[model samples]
Target: MLEDKNQEKTSLSELGEFGLIKHLTKHFSSYHKTTIKSVGDDAAVIDSSEKQTIVTTDLLIEGVHFDLSYMPLKHLGYKAVMVNLSDVYAMNAEAEQITVSIAISNRFPLEALEELYAGIQLACNTYNVDLIGGDTTSSTKGMLLSITAIGKANKEDVIYRSGAKPTDLVVVSGDLGGAYLGLQVLEREKQVFQVNPENQPDLDNYTYIIERQLKPEARKDIPELLKELDVKPTSMIDISDGLSSEIMHICTQSKTGCKLYEEKLPLDPQVISTCEEFEIDATMVALSGGEDYELLFTISIDDYDKIKGNPNLSVIGHITEENQGMNLVTRANQEIELKAQGWNSFKG
Candidate 1:
C-alpha cells in the first residue's frame, strides 16, 4: 500500500527543493495576524505583541516514531502537526503558527509529498495556524518531520509543570488507552496482510480507536474551556507520553506526590471493550499508552467546583506531600507505586 505503481508518480527531483516548497505551500493562507511573513523569505517573521510567546518543536523519525505500512501519509502529516501543537497547548496558550521541516528519501514522489502537505494544510486550516519557514532536504532512508509550534498567552496566563502544589486536583481532558490499542489493531492487521496479501482487514469495529492512533487532535480547546470556566491550572503537561509518565513529570517538577485513582481514569467505551478483547490490563494500557495527545494538569482544590460536571474534563487524582510518593490507588484497594513505564523510544 505504501507504493502505488498505477498512480501518477512525479519524481521529487523535478521540482527541486525550492520549487517543491512553493508548490506545496501555495494554498496555505495565513490565519494569524501575528504572522508578518510566511514561506519564500530569508526567514518567516511574526509580530508578537504583549502576550508571552511559547515555542515547541518535535522530531519524528520514520521507523522510530512511525511505521508507514499502515499509517497514511496524510494522517502522518496531520499527526506530526498535532505532536507539536499539543506541547504548546499544554502551556495553556493559543497556538498561532507552525514551521514544518522535512527530510525525505528519493523513494517518495512529488505527488506523495503533495499528499503529505495536503494533510498539513488541512490541519493548519482546521486549527487556524499559519505555515512559517522550514527547510527541505533529502534523507538516506525514510521520512523525518520536525514541526515547531508557536503560540501566545498573556503574561499572567502561561502555565508550567513546576507550579503544582499540594492538594491541587489532577485533571485530564478526554480519555486514554485508545491510541495504543489502535496501534495494536493496525499492527495486527499489518502482520495479517504480510502473511496473506489478499486479506482485507475489516476495521469497521475499530474506527474510533484507529483514528485515535492515526489522526489525533491536539487539545486546543481545553485552555479555552478553562478560561471560560474561570479556572486556571497550576501545572500542566500534554499526555504525549502516558498518564503515569506525564503525571510523574508534573510531580517531579512541582516537588509534590500524586495519587491517581484507577476508577477515575477516563476510558472510552471502545477502549474498554478493546482492552478486553486484547486480553491486556486496561489500567496499564491507560497508564502507558503514549500518543493520546490529551492535556493533563493540576488545579487548586478551590477550583474543583468550577470544572466538576464538565464532560470534557476528568478529575483523576490530587496532589500530595512529597513524602507520600507517587502512587496509583487501584480499584482493588491496593496502592502501587507509579513508574515512568510509558513510551520509551530507546527501550530495547
Candidate 2:
C-alpha cells in the first residue's frame, strides 16, 4: 500500500497543463463586479463600464530577484501580488483583479505549490481583489512569478507620474529603508547559518525590518485617504526601487526639478536602530534602500493643510523649476546631486 501511494504522487508531466490549471484554480472565486469571467475561459472578461482601466505587470525571478533560501514560498506569493497592485494604487486607481502566472521547476511538489497558493488567497482576501486568471508552466531552473494587476478609476481621477509641476509638495506614505535593512539582516543570518549550522538565530531584534522585507504591504489606503481629504495628487509612484530612483522618475517624467531634504525623509525607529547597529548611514538607506512599497506623491501646495499633520503622511520635499536641477539638501545645508541606487534585478 505504501509503495502504491508513493507511486500515485503526481508530477507535473502526469498532470499536464490543463489538468494542473484546473486542480490549482478550482478553489479561487471571483469577488469583483468588473470580473465578469474569471478562469475557465479563453481570457478573463472584465466589464470596465464607464471607468478607465489601469493595468500593470511585474515579474520576479527566483535567483535574480529573490533568494528562496530565506524567502518562503508563501511570503513570495503574497509579495508578488502586492508589488503589482502597488503600481495600480500609485495611479490612484482601485485594484480589482489580478492574473498570477508562475513557472516552477519539477523539484517543487504539489504540496509546495499549494502552500504558495494559500498565501495568494490570503492576499486576495485581504485586499478584496479577485483572482481572475493566469498560467502555470515548467521552469528549467528556479521558480518565477509574473503578476498582472488590473484596476479602474474615473478619467478625471487618474494620476500619472508626469503630472507634477513646480511648487508642488512632495509627500511619502510610511517610513523608508525597513525593507532593505530587513534584507541585510536576513543575508547576515543566512551566512551565519552556513558557517555554523547548529546556531539558532535570535531574530527578535530584527522583527519589524524582517517583516518589512518578507511581507511588505502595498499602500492600498493612500488613494482612499486622498479622496476623503479632497486632495488630488498631481503625480505619484510606489517606492519599489528606492526613494531616490522613484523621485528621479517623477522629476524626469514631469520635466521638473526637486529639492529633497535629508532630515525630512521618514525612517522607522527600528530602521534607525538597525542602521546604527550595522554602522550604515540611515539617511542613505532611506534614500537608496528599495522595496519600501510606500506611496510617493506630489500635491498642490495650496492643499497642504489637509494632509499637513496626518501621521500616515510625510511631507519630504517640494518640486522645483527644471533649471534648478535635482538636489538633496543635507542637514548641514550642503547641496548634492541625487542619484538612483535602488535594487537592480539585472545587475551582475
Candidate 3:
C-alpha cells in the first residue's frame, strides 16, 4: 500500500502536514533500548541511563551544501544522516537515535519525498538507530534538512578535541581527498552534459571517487576497533572540514602544537590519479579537501605497538609543545605552517 502511494503523484495539500508526517515515518522501527518512545508523542522520550548523552545537529541547504541537479534525493537523505552520525562517532559514542526535519517546497511531489525517506530508512537500518521524531513544513524556496543525532558514551570513554597532550601520535582511518575529487568529476560531467545533452560520460574510471562524494559512509568501526585494541585516543574528531582544518581544531582545542607529515598522509589511488588529471596537488587536496568523514585522532605513543602496520589505520604525525606551532613537514623535509582551508559555509 505504501509502495503504491509512492508510485502515485499526490500534492502536499492533499495529505496536509500531519498526514504527510505519518505517511513518511510509518515504516521506522526502534532498535535501541535507549529509545523509550519514538514519534507520535508531544516529545520523543529517551533513557540515557548512567551514560553521558551527546547530541549534534547539522543543517543541509539544497544549493549550498549540495547541488540537486546531480544529487539524487535518496543519496541526499543517506548523506545527511551519515554526516550527523560521523560527528557522533568522532566523539567515541554509539548513535542511538536521530530526528530529521525538512522544509521542502510544494514543487516536490509525494513520490519525491518517499524516495528521500527511503534513503533515510536505509541509513537508520544500517546503523541500528531509530528515527525518533522530526517536523515537516512548507518551504518557499528549494529544500533544507536539519538532522540532530543523539548518542551515548560512558564519561570515561567519551573523547573530546581538548584531550590531546604533547607527544601523542596522530592517526587517521581510511583515506582522504577522494570526496572532493569526486565532486570535481561530477561538476565536470554536469558542465559537459549542459553543452552536449546527447553525450554520455564514461564514469567507470571515476567510480571510487564519485561514490566517496555521493555515498560516504561514517567511520562507525573505528571506535569499536580502538576498544578491541584497548587503545584510547587522547583526542579525536571527524574529517568533515579537511585534514588541515580538523588538525587545527584539535591543536587549538588541546592547546598543543602538531607536525603533520605530508609523506604520511594517506590517499586512495583514485584520488592521486584524479589530482594529476585535474592538475591539482594531491597533498593540497588531502590537506584542504573536506568530507572524507574519516576519523582523525591522537593516541598515546605507547599504544603505537598495537596499531602499528594496521591496514585500516595510518600514523600521520605527532603532537608537539605549544610553542612549536602547527607545521607540515613536506616530503623533502621542508617545514611549512599548516593553514585552515576547510569548508566555510558562511563564506558561501
Best-fitting candidate, scored by lDDT: 3
Q: Predicted candidate 3: what Cα RMSD to the true structure? A: 11.4
Tens digit per residue, CA lDDT, model 1, 2-120 = 67576578766556544587899999999998765466421233556776677777889999899999889999999999988898888777888899999999999999899899999
Off by over 4 Å in 3: 1-49
Residue-by-residue lDDT tens digits, candidate 3, 206-273: 99999999999999999999999999999898999899988888898799999999999999999998
User: Mind giving the per-residue lDDT tens digits that candidate 2 earns over 126-234?
Assistant: 9999999999999999899999998888767777788999999999999999999999999999999999999999999999999999999999999999999999999
Judged by whole-model lDDT over C-alpha atoms, candidate 2 comes out at 0.88
Question: After superposition, which runs of candidate 2 have C-alpha atoms over 4 Å from their true positions?
Answer: 1-49
Ten-residue region with minimum lDDT total, candidate 2: 36-45
Distance from true location, Cα of 225 in model 1, Å: 0.6
lDDT of each: 0.88, 0.88, 0.90
TM-scores, all models, native as reference: 0.86, 0.86, 0.86
- Poorest lDDT segment (10 consecutive residues) of candidate 3: 36-45
Q: List the residue pairs that clash in candidate 3.
A: none
